[model samples]
Target: MNAIHNTYWLLAAAAALILIGIGSSLLARRFGAPLLLVFLVVGMLAGIDGPGGIRFDDVAGAYRIGSFALAVILFDGGLRTRRESFRGVFAPTLLLATVGVVVTAALTGLAAQWLLGLGLVQALLLGSVVASTDAAAVFFLLRAGGLQLRSRVGATLEIESSANDPVAVLLTTLLAEFLAAPSGIEGSELLRELALQFGIGALGGALGGFAIAAALRTLPLSGGLAALFLGTAALFVFGATGSLHGSGFLAVYVAGVIVGNRNVPGFANLLSVFDAGTWLCQIVMFLVLGLLATPHTLGDALWPALGIAAFLMLVGRPLAVALCLVPFRYGKREIGFIAWVGLRGAVGIFLASIPMLMKLPNAELIFNVAFVVVLASLLVQGWTLGLAARLLDVALPHRDRAVRRVELDLPGSLEREMVGYAVAPGATILIGTALPGWARLVMVVRNGEIHMPDVAGSLSSGDYAYLLAPPGRVYRLDWLFAPPDEAIEAEREMFGEFSFDADVRLADVADFYALPIRAKDAPLTLAEHFARRYEHTIEVGDRVRLGPVSLIARELDDDGVRKVGLKLERLGNVLVRRPWLARLLPQRFVAR
Candidate 1:
């Protein structure tokens, strides 16, 4: 009966917590705040102090839950990473993960011992746990916020976040064991464990990802049941690898990336489902960490926590980013931006829970400090990211107009069947007003329209013309668009007859368009009129056409005209929305 009651109470607690999470997420937008912090606050409310007096002081349970949540989060993150993104950022990211983490841990531990008057081992425990930035939290928040960096600064952060977990975890565990046993963890043993964990983790992730991809292709299930299989397989890879003394997080992440990128049988819808799942994981993870805290203990750790946060943000992260990024030719702004954006969240809290689980001394202090650090990061770093970007002049100025490119969701299967070609300088149809041969212009893509061009419709030099040639002949659609250098001499044979230089002619009214003259231009065109017919160029009913585009001339005097150009109504360029920026983010992983 007691067990039954406990189960009911636990279910009720979970239900209430979910509602709180939902409410917090909804309210977060209004506050211009991060939802993770909100989730933690909500969890705190449910603790011993707030409305629901559910006392959850179970450190071991918290650690277990936190660990599992982290695994899920990391796996999801890994699955989404594109292999291509790793090429540029990998070296620096690796350095940040290994060298940077070690340096940070050592420095932070020293600081903690000096400032907080803690023993070396306890300080090391705290330092080791908090040393690495929380990749899951940082990556998720950055991506969700739709923040765009000029280059792979964001990717480096993400890679560091995902990769640093194992290092921090390794450090914390080793230190904990050393404290527990008089016989310290030998250097050789430490080295061996590190080697094994990384080696196995990487290998496991690769193998597991390959396996999952294969299963996704071969397996068949309807009603979106396949997503469950994918999810289960991912979690299995994570758990199985970890159980085998491998980095399960690594395995799950690698597997997810592989499967996410592959042309699976049917995962378009599954991606959305998994995204939601990841969000759920984050919310639950943060909230659980918050619930495990006691407001009473936090007060004592507050000062130390603030100290650590300041040192890490001001000194450690910046130094690490500088050391790692300098060799990569990253500029001051890039390094500065990377340093500012190292927002910590779940991983630190999760690491804190580990010490608590082991019943290590000052566990509560660690938890409080970790929470404070997360809060500081979200408030200080998260909010100021855009401002920092601007101050650093890292952002490019907005253009007056932009063109939207056609995004082809071409089937991979059909890739082998199609041949893509760019309208080259020497192409018979594109050169000097000559139209493309019907054979070459099998399909012309212009302004989002794909159609067979009429013989009279000339192929402009910039057009992308598709040929109906067999696809297996080329490796990629891009290959079809290769420059003349890659083309056969026979391909160039068609260009010899075309004129290389032709004086392009515009219509007679190229510069002279018949429109209601503006007051400023009125002096130029209708000044001889006996009476002033209208406000001139400054009048409301003025319009002009430039090529296929139209322009609206606002009524303005000479000085005004000098300052402001004609207001273009629908500029010649198509207003391309930012490539579904967030949607493109998911695709980046596949590229890797």
Candidate 2:
């Protein structure tokens, strides 16, 4: 009875922690801060030094829990990474993941050793710990900011961040072990170890992924059960790979990707379960890490930590990105944005916990410094990331996504769509207003709490509500949810291959696509230039064809043509006209 009572108390504490963590996330979101940063702050505030005064000094437990959390997070990242997503950016992504990471670690190691006065091995280990750009942080901020990036640049950064974690993990583990041992590290032996670890990791992950996909295909289970089974298999892969001294992280991640891409039973449920689990794990992991940190020691570690962060952000990250992407032909602006967005979060902190668990020299200090680096990254870099993207001229205009989403269930063969709405500030959707006949308000999430508001409850600003609605009525929902000004700004549909941007100059773009921009000397916008020769009736979606090029009006307001999309047809005819240029078609002429 006493043991059961203790268990209940633990559960109570966990529930409270989660509740507080969520509140912190909301506050952070409101203040334009990174959610993970707030989570860390809240955890620290609730710890021994702060008001809550809850003592937690379990380094080993935190390490174990954090590792498990990372495994789940990495697996989820892999699961969502579709093969088609990396189509043209694979080479650059691979280089950034492998070569860029190594350069970052080396440069950071040098800085740490010089400034922080740690020994070479220890400094190198610290470098390795923080070298990884946090996949969760980058993925979350980019997606949340609603910034569309030029395809190759965005995809490369996302893929690099996700794929590079395994490398950092491997380096951290090996370096940690090296620091713990007295044996002199030989160059040849180091190379062999690196090769072996990477080889086993890649091979194991590929095979494990295939195995998981095959197993899921053979066994048909209910959604919940299928997700449980998939989670179980992931754990199994991680454990089994570890038993063979392989990269368990890589194995788990690859398995997730393969399983995700395959036609698995209960795929949506799997994604949903993993998403929830990953969030929970992230919270618990960060909180536990914060609890482990002694606030008193941070005062001394703060300056040194900031110095290291400055060097990494200002010097190491950019250097690495530029060097690795040199051969890939990425523009300087795109590279600059990518360099600035290397926000360190959970992964760095997790690696920091390792040194503490090992009880290495100044382990506590290392942990403190590592945590501060994450703080600096998330607070400084993460906050300014979107702005930097815009300033660097690499940002894409946000694409309007389908607000209506449909999910189909197999057993019942039922199809359903849940349309989400954000009641913009000052937008009035009356509590008792009659909704469209095809729609029904299901639930409202206000200040992070879910409430099934009906006629009795008020709909106020910032309330995110969901509705079950037919696909056709999704557009009409704008008037109900969007602010008056937003409703006016919404663009009508356009026709084309959905290419190019509104902001680009026609003079700069004319010769590239061989566009029919006759007035090359005139300073005209893409939409403005196209509108002059465009004979089609001026509606929002009028398409104008000129030779092999197609131009479509993407956006229009009260004024005139706002944005135009361009698509160049096949260049076979162009190549036929100039036979000698046929050999360079795909490599040169067809680049646009």
Candidate 3:
């Protein structure tokens, strides 16, 4: 009876903690507090050091929970990552994940040696523990804060965060092993292990992802069952890879990328379920780590930990980033933003547990110091992320509000999905904006009445319209249903006053705007000029300056750029160059 009562009490307490963490997310967002920090604080408050006074010291259990949670978080991150994002960033991202991690660890290890008075191996281990940027922290803060960063910058950060964990884990484990028995390991064996970890992890992930995606497509699973199957299959891959002595974190993340990019059944269901699952995992992981920490013992190490954290944020991360990115010709602003966003979170704490698991000398000191560093990071770096992005000009200048979109898998086809959208008052669709040829409206619900596309005639405000579109292409239809007042205004300001077909010749634009162009290049179309300027894929919002005018890619398709918008760099300069155009053109065009 006592055991049963104790079990019940434990369950209730656990439930209460999770609920508090979930509820605290709202408050965190309101106050611009990092959600992970809030969760950690909640767990701390419930610990022996704080008011709740719950005595918990389960290091192994916390490590286990954290491993599982991080796996899920990485898998989800991979799933959400688009293949297109890797277009031009693959090389630089890889370097950042591998070479960059090493440099950061080296620099930070030096700081730890000086401040904490730790030996060489121990200092490096400490540095390795906190080396990788946490995927959960990066993903959560970016999404929750509603930041839409530039494509290159965002992709590099996301992919780097997901990919670098394996390196950090390997380094931490290797150092821990060396600390445990310095005589047993050889240099050649270390190299072999590194090769095996990455090679096998990548190969296993690709194979496993393909297998899961095939199963999802071939099996008759649906709804919740399909989502369940996906989660379990991913875990199986993770465990299998780890059992084979490969990096399970890398394997699982890669598998997610493959599976997510493939057209599998119940994709929408999988996304919805995994989104919730990752959130739960993050909260649970942070809470467990928090409970494992002995806050009272941290006072001795607080100042040194703070110094290390400051050095990491100011010197270590920035120096490493600049070295890795300068060869790639990344702009100063892009490098600065990426360096600042190298936030340490759950991964560091989780890695610190390894030393505890190994029973290393000064393991407690490492754990406490790591805890302080993570706390300081989340408090300072997380809070200022949005502000830094804005000041650094890495964030794209556009409203990133949520669109009311619902996606349902088509019964017989993987190529198409049934997507529904709520028509806003000033939607472009209401003004007869045509959707892409690939999209076809099939149904409309207006004021509680269901009508076929033909019966509905035209979509009106307050109508719910459903269209059949390729699974991943539904986002292209968003602008048609979006309330365009703000979006249109913003686009006009950013792009230009007017748009012209990309096929328009540079000579014609130069003649009209009274701008000089090289005679050899004058015959080239705007699209051709953009193609020449950018060796990689040219996305919308890409701009090219032409004397006092700027040409922006307004619209693009598979064929190439479809439309180009032109903006005068300085209205006064343009007027001075072509004085008569002030009287000939409307005030809108002349005033820029």
Candidate 4:
């Protein structure tokens, strides 16, 4: 009877902690606190060291929970990552994920050895534990802060955060093994292990991802069932990869990317389910880690942990990022922003658990110090992320506001989704913008009454319009429904005053504005110039400078650039206002 009562009490406590964590998120967002930190604090408060006085010290249990939670979180991150985001970023991102982790670990290990007085191997283990950026923390904060980073910077960070975990995990495990049996390990064995971890993980992930995608497309599964199937299959892949001594984290994340990029039925449903699932996983993982930590024990290692955290954030991360990104030609601002966003969260704490599980020397010290480091990181770096992005000029100008969008799966179809949007006042569609040729309007809801597109005539403010569009191409429709103010602000501020057809000859524009043009390049059109300048596919917002003027790609299509916006590089405000006078004078004189 006492055992049954104790079990009931444990269940209630767990439920209460989770609920409190969820509720505290509102305050975290309102105050710009890191949500994971809030969850961690809640669990700590309920632990034995805190007022709640719940005595729980279960390292093995916490490790199991953390591993599962991390797998789900990584899978969710992969599913949301669009394949187009990888264009022109794969090489740099890969370097950051692999070589960058090693550089960061090496730099941080030196600091740990000096501060914590640990042996070389143990110091490197400590460094590797906290090396990789946490995917959960990065993904959550980027969305919560409402940041629209430049394509290159954002994609690199997202992919690196997801991809680097496997490298860090491998490093930590190898170091822990070395500490456990120093005489038995060798350099050649370590190299072989690293190769197998990556090679096998990659091959397995790719195969599993394709299989999952194919099943989702062909199976007649409902939305809920499809989500469950995907979650289970992802875990299966993770387990299978680990059983083969490969990096399970890498396999699961890669599988997620493949499945997400493929055309599968019930994608919207999968996203919605995983969105909630990832949140739950993060909360649980943080809570368990928090419960595992004893705040009183952390006091002994607090200062050293704080020192290590400070060094990692300032010197270690930035130096590694600069070294890794120099060959890639990343701007100073981009590199700085990426280094600043290298937040350590559950991954660090989870990795620290391995030392405890292995019973290595100073294992308890490592866990306690890691706990402090995570806390300090959340308090300092997480708090300043938004400001850093803005100060460094890495965040892109806000061009779109969120709108009410609903996606519905079409039965018997894997290619199309029925997307619905609430037409806002001053929406481009409400004005004169036309839907793409591939999009077909099906229905509209006005005043809670549903009507066919023909009967509805034209969409009005507050009217809900539904259209069938290819899943991959639906994002292109968002601009048509964007709020008027953001659209106007974007056009006026970032895109410039005048728009023209992209097919216009550069020679004609140069003659009109008195721009200096080389004889060889005089005959090139704006589209041709963009194609020549950018090696990858040209996207909207891409800019090419021609002497004093900048040509911005304002619109795109299957063929190439459709429209371009001209901005005076130096005298944009002054010359734009005096358009007639500016046209008459040479651009050099206008600049003076």
Model 4: which ten-residue window has the lowest total lDDT? 583-592
Specify the highest-TM-score model's number. Answer: 3
Q: Write the per-residue lDDT of candidate 1 for residues 1-592, one digit (tens) a residue.
A: 9999999988887878988788867877675677677788888888886776768887777777777778778877776666666877888889988888888888888888877888998888888878888876677766766655544665787778888888888888888887777396788998998888888988888888788878777877663577777777877887888888976766776777666566776455666677777787888888887787776777666887888989989998788779877897776767888788777887887788776777778877877787788778877887776678667644422221112222222222332233455565554433243222222345777666776867427666667766542322222223234343443232222221111111111121123322333344344322222112211212212223343333322222333221111222443322223324324332211121
Residue 7 of model 4: what lDDT? Answer: 100
Taking every candidate in turn, the Cα RMSD to the unseen true structure, in Å, is 15.6, 12.9, 5.2, 5.7
lDDT against the true structure, each candidate? 0.65, 0.73, 0.86, 0.84
Q: Give lDDT tens digits, candidate 2, residues 1-592.
A: 9999999998998789889889767777777777777778888888898887988998888888887887777778788776666786788888888888888999998998988888988998889889988887877777766766655667777778878887898788778777788586666777787777677877787888888878877987777777777777788888788677777877787787777677666766667876777788778888887787775887766788899999999999999999987787677776788899888988898888787878888777778888888889988998887788767756643435323233332211122356677777655365344676777787888888888967427777777877776432355566566555444344322233334555466665555445564565347765666545432123444455656766666555445566665544557544346656435433322221
Per-prediction backbone clash count: 19, 0, 0, 0
lDDT per residue (tens digit) for residues 1-592 in model 4: 9999999988998899999998998888888888888999998898888887877789999999999999998999898888777887899899999999999999999999999899999999999999999888899888877877867888989999999999999999999999999999999999999999999999889999999999998999888788888999999999999999899999999999999888787686778877887888889999988888886876656788889999999999998889888798787778889999998999999999999999999888888888888888888888888888778766654544346578886534556779999888888898888898989999999999999988999889999999999864676677688776766655556667677777788888777777777898888987887766553346677677777777777777777787888777786544566667645654422220
What is the lDDT, from 0 to 100, of the residue 520 in candidate 4? 87
Compared to the true structure, candidate 3 yields what TM-score?
0.82
For each candidate, give its TM-score against the true structure.
0.69, 0.72, 0.82, 0.80
List model 3 lDDT by residue over 443-548, tens digit each. 9999999999889998888999999987545665776787777546555666776677887788887887777788988889988987766533466776777788
- The number of the candidate with the highest lDDT is 3
Error of 4 at 556 (Å): 6.6
Better model by TM-score, 1 or 3? 3
